[model samples]
Target chain A: MSVHLLYAFAGAGVFTIGLFGMVFMVHLLRKLLAFNLMGSGTFLVLVGLAQHRNGVDPVPQALVLTGIVVAIAATALALVLIRRYFHLTGQVTLEPGSRDDEGHS
Target chain B: MTSWLLDGLVVFMLLATAVSVLASRSLFRAVVMFIAFGMLMALAWVRLQAPDIALAEAAIGAGLTGVLLLDAVAHFRRGPDKERGGAS
Candidate 1:
């Protein structure tokens, strides 16, 4: 296979792994990590596939650049929200019984 | 031949780190693995002939995001009581 095709396959694997982690992981931070991983995987597939067909495309690369910036902003915002949630609830995971005393108040 | 070997190595490391980021026992270790994954991603971008992305991945992906997540990890490690105490 071509080099770009190899990277594209790798990206698919990463995306699947991230999807599994996002679904199964209990901790919000871990979920956020999985979300970022998924984004990265998508970016890789975009660039790799585009370049695989058309030899060093600039459009997809630019798109991925913008995506990376947006991703960091989203991650920071998620971390802030997570910290606030932890401060109020004292729980990391969103599983039930995290706020038993409050009782959904 | 050498280039293909190098590309394969980078891809392998990328997947390995991505898995470890989820599978790690400790939260801090997981975040650290994520940072390493970002750096490897930068290398992958370089191999893909996206130098601009490699730079951004190195700066934002590995450096800034790593520091941000590390700070959050430290905050979580402090426990809610301590954080509340310090905040108030």
Candidate 2:
């Protein structure tokens, strides 16, 4: 098998593993980490697919670049929310009853 | 020389990184492993002939994401619920 194809397969496998980890892990931080892994895996696949006879496709590379920016923005927002939730409830895990409304009523 | 062998080694490293990322005990360790994974992924991109992706991955995937994760870990560590660090 060509090296490029191998990278594609391995990336897909890691992507799946990371997806499973994100879904099963109870910790929010771990979930976030898993999500990053999945994103990297997707990037790897895109890179592999972009490889061509003379050169790689610039289109997929551009898309992947955009994806990385979006991922970082989303991650920053999520981290802010996690911090706010912790300050409000003093708990890492978000409990349904721990909402701000419960404190007032 | 067998060139395919080196490719196989890269695949093994990628798989190992995936496992470490999922199985790491400490949140910090997991995040670090993820950064390593991104670096390896960039190498894979270069191997695949996508220099643009290699540059993007090195910058945004590894650099920006690493900063974001470190900030998150710090945010969580400073919470009032220090007693419940392992509540997860």
Candidate 3:
């Protein structure tokens, strides 16, 4: 198979793994990591698909660059939120078990 | 040819590390594996003919994310909140 074809399947596999982690992981940070993995998988597919007969199209490259910047900013914001949550509640995870506490309040 | 062989190896490494990252119990080990996964993904990007993505994956995905995770881990170890379940 060609390079694009190989990476396309790889991209799908990565995406699936990331999706599973995101759904099953309870930790906020792990979820964020999984989210990043998912995004990277999508980038791979986009770039892989952009390959034309002779060369790669530039649009997807530009989109990926934009995605990278966006991903970083999002990660920073997410980390900050996690820090804030810890500072406020002393909890690593916002467990559903804590809803009783919320209900009492 | 060497090209296909190398590509296969890279893909294998990428998927393997990804699985390890998810399966690892220790938060630190998982993060470390994640960084390695990102590097392998960067290599895959290069192989797929996307140098710009490779650069971004290395810098943003691997480098920045790794530092961020390490900071979180350090804070987790020493901070007042303490470790709860689901750290891994």
Top candidate when judged by DockQ against the true structure: 1
**Every model's TM-score:** 0.93, 0.81, 0.87
State candidate 1's TM-score: 0.93
- Tens digits of per-residue lDDT, candidate 3, A54-78, equal 4677778789889988988998899
Docking class of 1: medium
Error of 2 at A5 (Å): 1.3
lDDT of 1 by residue, A1-105 (tens): 689888988899899989999999888889999999999999999999999999999999999999999999999999999989888888878896663221111
- Provide the clash count, candidate 1: 0
- Share of true Cα-Cα contacts across chains kept by each model: 0.65, 0.74, 0.46
Candidate rank order under DockQ: 1, 2, 3
Worst 10 residues of 2 chain B by lDDT: B79-88
**Chain A TM-score for model 2, please?**
0.79
lDDT of 3 by residue, B1-88 (tens): 8998998898888788888878887777888989998899889878877788788888887889889888876665555344453443
Superposing all C-alpha atoms, what RMSD in Å does each candidate have to the true structure?
4.0, 5.8, 5.3
Pull out the clashing pairs in model 2: none
The worst-scoring run of ten residues by lDDT in candidate 2 chain A lies at A96-105
Candidate 2 residue lDDT tens string, B21-58: 87977767778888888788777777777777678778
**Please, what are the lDDT tens digits per residue for candidate 1 over residues B1-88?**
9999999999999999999999997888999999999999999999999999999999999999999999988788777767555542
